[model samples]
Target: MHRSERVSMYGWIWRHLPGNTWVRAGISLVLVLATVFVLFQYVFPWAEPLLPFGDVTVDEGGAGR
Candidate 1:
């Protein structure tokens, strides 16, 4: 996106936020925490079984002996 579009989007978000800096900061923090909680609780568990992250096997030659 262009610089003006980016700035406008940010300005829009800032204007929609409910309060001064501290309250907005608190709201942003809550949003971030909620996003993390949802991902860990629901998304990660559902995706865990589909990932190829299990049963790693490695073979090493005896040349180091």
Candidate 2:
């Protein structure tokens, strides 16, 4: 089968996960939490300086003066 017809990486992981449905759900939740922790602790901080969010502009002394 073609790559597009193949199962997604997430689907493959879910199928390969051990135990029953509840166990898979718990594992999935842990994976999500770990992913989020890594992003906030490392990825976001490293990428913050390269992002345009810090260039925010605000109206001084109220709007429509």
Clash count list over all predictions? 0, 0
Best candidate according to TM-score:
2
* 10 residues in a row with least lDDT, candidate 1: 56-65
lDDT of each: 0.84, 0.94
> All candidates' TM-scores?
0.70, 0.72
lDDT of 1 by residue, 1-65 (tens): 77766667556766789999999888878978999999999999999999989966755765575
Model 2 RMSD in Å is 3.0
Q: Give a tens-digit lDDT track for model 2, residues 1-65.
A: 89769888999999999999999999999999999999999999999999999786887867877
Give me the displacement of residue 59 in model 2, in angstroms: 6.9
